[model samples]
Target chain A: MSEHILETQNLTKEFKGFVAVSNVNLSVKTGHIHALIGPNGAGKSTVFNLVTRFLTATTGKILFEGRDITTTKPADIARLGMVRSFQISAVFPHMSVRENVRVALQRATGSAYHFWKSATSLNELNARADDLLEQVGLLSHADALTVELPYGRKRALELATTLALDPRLMLLDEPTQGMGHEDVGRITDLIRKVSANRTILMVEHNLSVVSRLCDRITVLQRGAVLTEGNYEQVSADPQVRAAYLGGSHAA
Target chain B: MTKIQARNRLYLLLVAIVIGLLAPLVVYPVFLMKILCFALFACAFNLLLGFTGLLSFGHAAFFGGAAYVTGHALSVWGLPFELGILAGTLAATVMGAIVGKLAIRRQGIYFAMVTLALAQLIYFLCLQAPFTGGENGQQGIPRGFALGILDLSNNTTLYYVVLVIFSLGFGLVYRVINSPFGQVLKAVRENEPRAISLGYDTDRVKLTAFIVSSALAGLAGATKAVVFQLASLTDVHWHMSGEVVLMTLLGGVGTLIGPVVGAGVVVTLQNTLSSGPLNAYVPVVLGGIFVVCVLAFRRGIVGEIKALIKQSF
Candidate 1:
């Protein structure tokens, strides 16, 4: 837990001759907020997909917690204590907020297959589920259907569900995408609060949030790491500025 | 489930039980029994399509496969009623596991196609198999006694037995849909990727549900064979599969009681109409009703009613 929680060695992915993520080496240390930042089409999502096994790597290896997971299934990767949250705040929309958390908690009760027992039996986990909801400041909306929740609230519920898994490492894909300034500030604080005793690897576009939250930052350009350092060093890197400015109209 | 929702379902069940117990005095027990069998069939199908969002087009394989097994068990093996139904259910469970394993690998319409194709293979096997009696089907399956005690030869007695089986099957469906397992099933239905990311082996979850639903469907089929003492090609036919889907949709797809209500209406119409002057137009009429139901309210009868009740509150 004190060393690297996730390591990818010369990882590469290609779609029929077009390289999407290429020869990238990434090592995320434990108990820290590690940010993967690049401009659009920088293969951030591709590397995530490769490590999570959503797509097979063209070449190279991935190791999580000292075990090779290059060929593992996505669910197995998660089961191995590397849970991922989607960019869009993936959740069971029709279920209540509490129910969403409970779904993740069901596996831990060791009775996820008990179809004969009443669901009320799962009420034992209600307190724990509520605590998760409370941790994310969503206790008041526990009974509300997830689809009925406002956009920001849905993101919080997603975090609660992710926390319910309590993985050793959490992969968040754009956890604060498409949010207002106030919502982003609130979520940044929430993520910081939840990062204790666990590793968080995030692919984020918002640099201010990254500099504010991440302990270490990896900058990618064209599917390969351009620089890896603290926020100040990465921000001061001339290549990082050129990649960002030339790649976008922001300048 | 919430206390209020559970109580509401309990009340609804009570009402249905009263009707089931007393209706035989006025209605022909055989007709009522047919309705019960199809109702159970529809309910089993709903567990997959309604609850789990899997649309299977080959359910008749399970239904009719169990019927043939039950028929053989009672007639050839001379087993008791309970054992015969259990044999049939076991056969369907095996079938479900195999079919689910293969079919669930594909998704959506491909899943439907896989089941349909596999069912057709089973249908052909039934037609060619020596024990199945080919076109004649397995016939004269004795109702036999329940545990060698009560006489199943009596229509009323058999009707009550069928009622018990239906109740058990329905209750099992209810418990499963409200169980911890059911939550994961719904989660998979709602968002499969999210479920997968949560460390759920979704294929396994889906397969388990398929087996349960198939076993229940087989139970209905076996019971029907016992009640009528016959298992025919019609039982395994694609039309039978289509008919169950119609029943589920006409009533309500996802609602617990929707399939039952749908089966009752469909069976009643098929009975009263096909046996009367409107027999030739029975299919047309049923088709028309299905069209109207889809167009006017795609949620079906029970779903629409539930929506209205929710709206009022």
Candidate 2:
């Protein structure tokens, strides 16, 4: 069996005259938390966009579970057990938290066209949504409108919704981008808990978060991989230090 | 079970229907039927604009196309009432599919424009078609018996028949808006991108809503042709489309009961004003109402009342 859940060979993306991500090779092993860390304009989000089928790769191939999915639509890719969470909080703001999760569950469970059945009567769907919300510690706010929740709570809701898709691979873009340290710690813990049975490929700017959560880290500079190893190994490497981390740390 | 808040709503509707049925005995049955027809038309329009967040300017296609079909079927081919209505509805469904396929390619203001242009094209087609009697329209349509038993030629019997069909159509609209599909439509209106990311094919949902709305509009139009015993070019005119829109907006855009109330108000206003010398100014009044509704009362009358109720509760 293939160890890689997702693999990209020489993936490249260009917008007009600028190359956002160039000549990148990335592989995420099943049940591993792989973090991609870099400064601004490192094309981390661009790489995510390409992999998720939101943006077509200018050149190269993407393989998921050893099957090529380079030409699949985003929704089709998502249905095939790979889901992504946006960098900015994305949620149905007017819907109650429970409804948001139920919609996703409905999509996952193949009931998208059952119009006559009252959504409230779908006790199984509600129970499943409740369970996922409880997992994210958001069960208390289940009936609250999504717009009313705090920012961190909104992020938690996004995770619950994504989890409702029953994905085998999860792509997270800056999960804790604007969170306070305490909230960051809680979210990091949540990510760790979710990473147990799923492959997680995350683009994180916060070095401490990458150090704490990642099993292996890949450093990128100018859209190319500068180095890849465990945090200590990549952090101390002379070439990675010069290109990305800067010489002060190595000196 | 939980105090049945909708019971009061049921009671109000029952009272209104009773009064409507009794109106012809005291006033005029033909006029009452016309009002009921317009009321149903506005309700159907509201299903798309208020609940689904789609503003269809081509509703005239459904309404007018059904009128022409129902009129021709009743007067020329001599079909029964129910079959005529069904034929009319099928015609609208076909038109809905064609227009929906094209209109859904755009969003917001462009959506309105695309539907409007399509409706205008239909209006011209109706003008040129031989069966429609061209500019003169088909007149003297027979109000045949319901299932060949109800004797719809009798003014009282025909009035009741129209009343029942209108009530059923309105009830179905209410039921659809309260369904899960309706909630998803609201979610799409509130945020399209979020709904898409949540795995909904938003385009499919919108298309379904559009077809349903058009079919119901056809139902209303067919009933009107039977009641008035005429189907004229006026039914398909762009002004008729604007009138239904105005009714929905004045009553309340998103509220379930607003469109019915708006339909009643506009029909009543037009009837009363037509008898006086000021009849020519009805369009100006409608224009003013639209401007006022947009500028000062974006929520419409029903939305305002609901807000007040929420505050009081």
Candidate 3:
């Protein structure tokens, strides 16, 4: 296996003459929890979107496990073991909490196309969903509507659903974006637990979480990587501090 | 589903069967059949609108287009009753595939408009088409003998057949909504981007939903033509499309029996008012009910009842 799970070379995304992500080269090492940090409008999220194929790269090549996936469709990328999470906790609001994870598990079985069969027949997946829910500490809320969950719990549900994919490279866009202090701590621990045998490329605004959890941190400034290093080196760099000096995400 | 809910559904099913069996004895058979046809149409339309979150405003094309084909097959081609209905259904399914392909390219209000435009195209085609006999439509369509034995010429026999077909269609729709595919569809409806991230081909799923809705609507249309012994311009009219939407919304957008109940009420209202002095006010009454539904009871009758029951429990 290659040292890197994913690599984006000269990735660029231009929206109507405005360059959102400019000539960015990013790589995530295998089994490493990597953090992409940047101020608002720094284009960290844009990089995530480009790598996941949610938005087409204006120019560049994205390699996953040494295979080019630059032109692949967004929906097809998940099947290739690179799954992404939305900045918002994107659970099916009307569905039961259990069903949210169950839908993700169904992706593994490829039974999402079976309309004639009873959804109950997929009861076999319920145990796995329960296990996933338990892992995210959402076992108690399994039967409740996802929409009814508190903000923190909903993010937990989103994590469970993402973990259901068992992805080789998990791309989480601001995993704990709108979370409270307790939620941030809980999700940081959850991310550490889930990242044991997988690669994680996370766009996080919280510097504390990044320093604690991420093996490597890449800071973006004005749509390009300003600095890339271990958390200690990146945080200690005077240039990195200067870039974040006036920003709200300063450490 | 919970045990209580399952039990309640069973009770509802038993009651529905009892009512279906005896409805002709009390109500006019033709009128009841009309309600049944529209009920099935609304249910099919609901499958798209409620479950898939696709608002198709051109459903009249499938419903009326199928009626025209079935009428043509039975009247001009002299096909068996079953074959004619199948012909109509297949035609509608094919039409759905074509129209759904185009409509699924857009979403939300645009999707609705595309379907509406396609249905209008079909309407114009039917108007000028020789098989449809222009505005007069294909009339005097022989009901024919079903299965070469059961004489559908008898209104009583026809009613039972229509009932059975409606039951099967409704049951199939119910099964579909409760299926794994249906769950995925609901996910798509709730959040398409999330569903795509889960590796679902949301477009394909939407198209499949559109086709299923169209086929069922066609089945209803074919049955309606045979029951009325005529396929006319009224069946294909844009107003008919609006009527099905009204029925589904009034009954309950996502509820299983909402469309059926809505259809019954609307058809009965039209029937009752057609001969009375209130005929001119029927549209106004329906419009008022729709306004009330949107403003006061956004979930429709069945949806409100469901919420009420859940609260009480």
Candidate 4:
């Protein structure tokens, strides 16, 4: 309804006396692939956590689709259509790959609260679950135990499960972190493919992936925004260059 | 479940049924009923530990608490056995709701601590309560007629009754773990934060599981009261709580049938070693087996055997 899908106004979070995310205002436009880029300890994940209500903001207002959700419970916020992924692959490791996706789709079947009903009642979710898996190239591994999947494949499976939610806004924290080069590229491409129709806000370390996939970038330094622009504009900014060099040195 | 998996489970259940029918013939009926009662207790405990990932150390409160309630209802009020057990189950359910509400506010060791502390309180209450008969226990509890006709006085008749109750509890657990709700519980166990981000109300899920486990445990205890015609402080003791944990862990915490096997082994070992030259070493043998289970057979006997089979194929 608003120009921005998600807007955080003067958000700030502090632990004890230390500030993790300083006063920050971020607006993610609808249907845009927005990237929050920062070095380690720049509070990127903290922002994601705060936005998802995993952590309470010391001071701020978060608006999702123009609705004030700064005080909403985390689970309620998620059900309100804003879902997040963890820095690590979020999954049910003991279940099969398809079953992992089915967890998200199971809510649609209205039997998530029915313990007496057989799990086979979820058969209706299978076609969609497999379709999501195929989208992430995990269809062949549908029957494999989630824990047994290779690391890269596990990340792919995370994407499939997230997609199963069909969320209005997807907050992915470091979707390609701890991956090999091929995996990073494939994940970057997968993100691009899935970015249609929905809005996305991601925290990524790889600048090339950011440049290739993200429509807009917000560079953060010391828990504050350093600069914001399109890739070329950000790449040409001198302060952005110094921050990257400083960030790398700090890393 | 897949077709092959369902068939395998069916075969397993059939085998259990066959064993239940024949074990009383080869073994003492009273001893076999004891095994069945404990097996149901262990399985009910497993629903929380293995499936839901909640380790409730105060389960003795539910198991023993129901025994006292059933004992009072039957001996003092002359209620039917079915209603007496039902009353006991309802009491446990109410206790579970209250305990679960408070305990789920914490997690892991803290959760276990809350349950343990509460169960210990229940033990003291049982010790001091006049109606419970204190140290003497509620002895001479009449084994009344079942469903108004079948005489439960016969050991063989009672064995079948006990078997039926165990089957009902086991079947309910199996059905629950394979249901959609069970999937959420496992997801909570596997990754609680992720489940939250996925919009599942984990607290409610956990509370429901706690209540179910408690009610089934109470059912087992009420039946035990009828079998032994006694309810004692021992049922609510911290030792009883610890015993169920040992059974669950030894049988394999997460495996459905593992707890039953674990309960059988422990009950049989205690029975066999109670009177012989090894009478003084019952605790030693049980502790030794528990250590071995934690060390090499970490999945418990059934879990390890199942894993071995899976790996072989």
Quote the chain B TM-score of every prediction.
0.98, 0.95, 0.98, 0.98
Q: Give the clashing pairs for model 4.
A: none
lDDT tens string, model 1, A1-251? 43999999999998988888889999999898999999899999998888999889999999998899989988888888999988887989999999999999987777778999988898999999999999999999999999999898899999999999999899999989999888899999999999998999999999889989999999998888999999999888888888875634542
DockQ for candidate 1, C-alpha atoms: 0.83
* Shift in Å, residue A85, candidate 3: 0.7
Docking class of 1: high
Summarize candidate 1's per-residue lDDT along B102-144 as a digit string, tens digits.
Answer: 9999999999999999999999999999999999998888888
Clashes of each: 0, 0, 0, 0
Q: What digit string (tens of lDDT, one per residue) describes model 2 on residues A93-115? A: 87889988887777755555555
> Which has the higher DockQ value, candidate number 2 or candidate number 3?
3
**Judged by DockQ relative to the true structure, which candidate is superior, 1 or 3?**
3
Cα error, residue A233 of model 2, in Å, equals 4.6
Candidate 1 Cα errors over 4 Å, as ranges: A247-251
TM-score, candidate number 3: 0.98
Q: Write the per-residue lDDT of candidate 3 for residues B1-313, one digit (tens) a residue.
A: 7898899889988998999999999988888899999999999999999999999999999999999999989988889999999999999999999999999989799999999999999999999988898978888899889889999888888899999999999998998999999999999999999999988888999999999999999999999999999999999999999999999999999999999989988888888887899989999989999999999999989999999988998
| TM-score, structure 1 vs. true | 0.97
lDDT of 4 at B244: 95
lDDT of 2 by residue, B146-261 (tens): 98799988888888888888988887787676656766787778766556656678898899889888998999999988888888888999899999999999899878788878
- Scoring only the A-chain of each prediction against the true A-chain gives TM-scores of 0.96, 0.95, 0.97, 0.96
| Highest DockQ scorer | 3
> What level of docking quality does candidate 2 show?
acceptable
Clashing pairs in 3: none
